[model samples]
Target chain A: MSERSLIASASQTIGPFYAFALTTNTALGVMAQSGAIGERIELVVHVVDGESQSVADAMVELWQADASGKYQHPEDMQARNPDPAFSGFGRLGTNAEGEAAFTTVKPGRVAGPDGGLQAPHINVIVFARGVLLHLYTRIYFAGDPANKLDSVLAQVPEERRSTLLAYPDRKRRELWRFEIRLCGEGETVFFDW
Target chain B: MHSYKRTLPGTQPNRRHDAYRSTLLRNPRQPLIQIPQTLSELTGPLCGDNPIGESDNDLTCHFAEEPLGQRIHLSGRVLDEDGRPVRNTLVEIWQANAAGRYNHPVDQHPAPLDPNFIGSGRAMTDDEGEYRFVTIRPGSYPWGNHYNAWRPAHIHFSLFGPSLLTRLITQMYFPGDPLFDFDPIMQSIPDEDARRRLISRFDLETTVPERALGFKWDIVLRGSGATPFEDAGK
Candidate 1:
């Protein structure tokens, strides 16, 4: 790589009172729109702290491919049909109970860096008042058969792999439950830049 | 060719800084695991159709009357690490009104909120990677972070560069703000020079005679470095 002169500027917190300015009259947190083809699922994410206390200020942003295993981004120069209804972008802040739920359809398999197929997954980034720099992670379905074949998931430790899995709820036919522990025991795995 | 540079350690604020009390419980203790940048990192959502409005960049004229405050023009370019222009990116900004009061239910600060000012704006960068906003200077506000914690006058900035790795959320400060030394959020950056990057410079060239003062702060985001070809020689 060529040597660069400017270094990227440091990041600052979003602060507590960013709700009014940041999320005013925009698509708050709708991931998959109507007419999008895929298994419609409601994903609920809970955020907790080292003391097991709920963190109410955290905001989660997720990006994934459509049901046809294709991203609608320009960088995904693949030969596949684009789902006009699916935006593949989901954003929502946690409530007082530290829950951020999304009405999104299940993402399909995507390509890895080396051109191999990857497991169905969602790329997640978390931002909060306390999170100085945003944290990166991924969410994978619990019963996905392709999990074993994911190269990225293989890099994570076996014990810590559970931190990335979102288990299906027994009562809700299309509900999946995932919790992110910021620190201490059972802390969710965070990826570095 | 689309790979990014590794972050220099200590340049960023610690997630567990003790001064910011909110970080005590919210910060993750474990070290972040390093991984290869996949397609997810290489690409980001293209906020297509330009959701920004014709006057979205100007926060002063949103209502029937002009807001009460010192008018200013905030302008800058979105550049990559190599100072290359990052074109067609989305830039979103939010701030307190001129009275240091946010138009939000959560802000309990005792200040008047201007009915004409919502304190929120969004704009898309041009081919030159530049963005301009016309708004009043936001006032300093007190916070419950600590005893008599008054935040410096600043505007919150959110940007989505071409790549997901380039996503950023930061605050842009006015030049020579008195709160720079006292604010934990400003002091959180370990490097003094890096912290100065957050402050905008007063530019005389962009200043209009009687209309608005001008300030410029070019933001730099993570960029793709030129990939060296080694496999060909081997």
Candidate 2:
């Protein structure tokens, strides 16, 4: 076999329709029950193949606490303010080369383990074949002063804490960009069961 | 004929074949379909480095094939029980080079190798399992086991079947390869005769000698599989 043969073999394709919308359209952290700060933000995640540094095919799922820091899942026994409009969950699969994009609203603040509250953000979980299990991480908006104060963000060791957040483009206003690399250089921290 | 004669397994007439014959006569059951096999077929379009679109200036990396091997125009149609050509079925294939070393990250077995040989490709079974690919003859490689370890030149295949759960994975070995006697993955199947099913038959009708050696290996996935998981419970 020649190098040409190997190069010829490294191609793949993504299907026509995105898989998420097939089941649910509920956006994660889109609102509070009373419909308070329902501002929408664009979220983009780039999935990469750790071994080859190539984009990998993957599926992404996201969910989070609502404006009042609550989830509507029926199993939750805590008598919290449940937002019928905001289910606090959403799912998206990556393209053939491991690229997934989500256009969703930023979730508002909620109470943390400590008395201090946290900022509006989205929680992201990714699934690919290489990893033995699912990879879980979070995305925080840059430029938000509350980001520095968010208790969850503060707890992640300094170097690792940055991996869970994204930088904001000042000129673009609400626009923000975040890329998650699965392996190789600058790999995001992953948690285990 | 190389001055050789082969003996049949159970045809030694008056010899004491009592126990084996008695068991076979009592059992009367055929055990051919119970074994498991791996599927490594290829389907879909011939891939280039860039999957986005047809770009003439596409970056041909060190591992990319600039002009790939001469493609053998092998084409065929796959029909179901009802004789309908099954459309949209995925076909995949992987094989050794004239020297063996899968173009995969996990395969590390060494042999005089072609650095550019990826030896893998795919084509979708048209409204039938009908599909085609352009590839070259894979080579054999040494498994480094001194006592006995060498794999015959073969191709791995996989089929998506009709559904997610219905997928099937298998491999195709070239016949007349003495290494088949020592390959572990092959021996794992338990049934010696069934193991031969994985090796392709040397069909003179399909092989073009100097041009290309062609083999038709068809597969059936378990059953109509399920769709992609939708939510938590699902």
Candidate 3:
């Protein structure tokens, strides 16, 4: 090995042709079935640019705790257990309508570091061509009282906190809609973490 | 205390002048958020013990018959910024067929698609962070990125590190691709050395005589050279 040896390859944007290279039946959605456990919910995520135009090429991934508020990850120090049927992780690519839909159960409240209860929320990671790097954020159910007590939500600016909430659809009982704006006014409150 | 360099530079300014329609450089209202790595960002998703068959790592064997193209042996190791092996991680790759056409629906390129090639494969790193895949050599294809622009032969790679923050998605290019000089996507990386890092080298030892040529490419995940997240405030 010599000095100034090549490091790993530099990343290029996941251009429009990403569908050509990356799309797979399992990569688009991870949940094995809809009959897992807890309250079944349908999450509709619309990714848009600053101009309010849909971003069809973006990839959206979701991570959440199981119905019992336990994560499937090894880092979860708590002794709580994960629901055997729930993988607690999923990935979906935005379609021409800029929507990435996931059929999952509502996650339960998890215990925060300070022994306080954190709000029920789903973590999201967005990757697109122009994004250069992926963006991190969370989706909290709108009108949930837990949002007022969540330590993570408290770190976000009061005015922009609403951007993280998703409202239930009027016609569809279990459907919720959340719009993520990558730039411009009303951009979703992206967290550093 | 360890000091890390901001090795990767920001987006290039010259790219905005390119005629590519999908270029991010032309996005006048892009967000300017400065990302700071936190504990959640630093940790990557842990993979479960999904069962793998012998053919999982071989892209050319999916179809009933062999894929129609020149066979290639691709091997690589996953390393952290400190140059230590990153074991138990997943390495995935996808690419076009030998005709420079994809097995996807949206690819309308005039090139013919090989029915025997689905063009996707995955392999988990061993204890030493090594992964190998046997696949056909992909060809170059034209894109609307610019006038008469064609992409060079390449393979897309996705890696999941120990933590979420280290997840890397990049493309591996062949050495001496003629289109390298004209590809705006490849030129987006500001550093000359970083661009060279994308090219895989010919490894005679790994080559199968009279069967396939071999190429070796190692992927380095974020670590010492990563931009210090704290500097985003300045």
Candidate 4:
């Protein structure tokens, strides 16, 4: 095939009216229900800008493997079985306070690209008005033993890695808290891939 | 070595770019990080067996009535960099009303909003990667981005490609919009040809007789390009 001359369209900001266009009942971020087999957990996220201000109009999406380490995607060619009850995906727009919460089970370890076992993590994508391109990151359980050995986490600078860890909430035992700062100090570790 | 444009410069909000809002908080510089694609990035969220229904593609009937203004039939295809159709992908659109006012709460434009138009719709691409929407042409609206700056008539589009990394959000503009040259947001892109890609062409073939006119636009995801690699040195 010949080299294509048409350049791909440049991206624009999600803008303020994205909620009016994209919101749906299912986008409220409930990946697994009561019948799903796993320890149910809630992920609470706050989207912030460089000045530590809340980004109320941002959209957050979560993708992860099922509790049994199986992804409900066609690309997962492994012989592992998936949890029928788990859809393994969720999306939600930030509220007036720049916060979004997801109800799902903690995912199990998945295979890393380097033939190693990656630590359990939830992949996150952020879209908002000020951001021209969507930001990509991961949420790792703060106390997970495998974090130190995870290939992806190992590549991050030691000091900045903590930004990717989601700590257990002090008041709520079932909830994990993650703060994604789009820029400035304590910015979350964003990925390019 | 293949050199692809990563990020365009002269687009920072603080760069006195009049078309977009100026703010101190925008990311001034972005480092191009090289990381291998993971399963999570390689896989995208599924839109279910039938992401769109017959009526979902029509923005004119959302509020139980036809929206006021000139109706149009906007059609497009979602293709990979290889030019193959990307079927079943979800396509979403939103825009201002015919009077340059959005139905959103934050919009304070003096123009009256059309009660019949909520200004949003969704559709899944067909086997040929084609999708269509029926909606009225949006009007130019004033924004506080700069002095006397009015956004050109345009529609916002969001698409979920085959992989999460390929997800894209862009705006589609009408051909021959007078504000195209003055709009800082449109001029933010450095390449002239790339900027032109954002404008849809008038398509008589897809136009409905005695109904809405047709406009054609196509979106190409990143996979259509050769594998991206980091160049040595700054």
Best by TM-score: 1
Q: lDDT per residue, candidate 4, B20-44, as tens digits?
A: 6533364423353456666766766
Q: Give the number of the best model, judged by DockQ.
A: 1
Candidate 4 error regions (>4 Å) = A1-6, B1-19, B22-24, B28-32, B48-51, B224-234
The DockQ for candidate 2, computed on C-alphas, is: 0.02
Q: Per-residue alpha-carbon lDDT of model 3 for B70-186, expressed as tens digits?
A: 899999898876676888887878888999998877789998978788888888999888999999999999987667999889998888776665666778899989999888777
Question: For residues A1-193, what per-residue lDDT tens digits would candidate 3 score against the true structure?
Answer: 2222335456665655666545555544645255677877889999988778998888888877777777776656567677887777778889999999888878888766456877888878787766544667889999899899987778777988898899899999689999898766887887642
Worst 10 residues of 4 chain B by lDDT: B7-16
| lDDT (Cα, tens digit) per residue for candidate 4, span A1-193 | 3355344557776777777777666544888877877778989899888788888888888888998778877767779677877778788889888899899999988878788888999988887776766678899999899998998988888988899899998888789999998777887878874
Can you write out model 1's per-residue Cα lDDT over B1-234, one digit (the tens) per residue?
Answer: 367887566667878888888887777787888888887778777664556789989999978899999999999999988787888888989999899999888888989989899898899999999999999999999998899999999999999898778889999999989899999898888888889999999999889898999999999998676533532432
RMSD of each: 2.6, 19.2, 5.3, 4.8
DockQ-derived CAPRI band for the predicted complex in model 2: incorrect
Cα error, candidate 4, residue A102 (Å) = 0.9
Task: Residues A115-176, candidate 1: write the lDDT tens digits.
Answer: 79889988888888877788888999997899998888888999999999999998887999
**Runs with alpha carbons beyond 4 Å of true place in candidate 3:** A1-9, A20-23, A26-37, A110-117, B1-20, B23-44, B224-234
- Cα lDDT listed for each candidate: 0.86, 0.46, 0.74, 0.79
What are the per-residue Cα lDDT tens digits for candidate 2 across B1-234?
A: 000011122211111112212111111121211111111011111111112222211112226553234323343444432233456665656565555555543357665446665455555665556765556656666554344456566655544443212233445666788877766545444445446655655445766668655555444332211222422244
On the 0 to 100 scale, the lDDT of residue B226 in model 3 is: 37
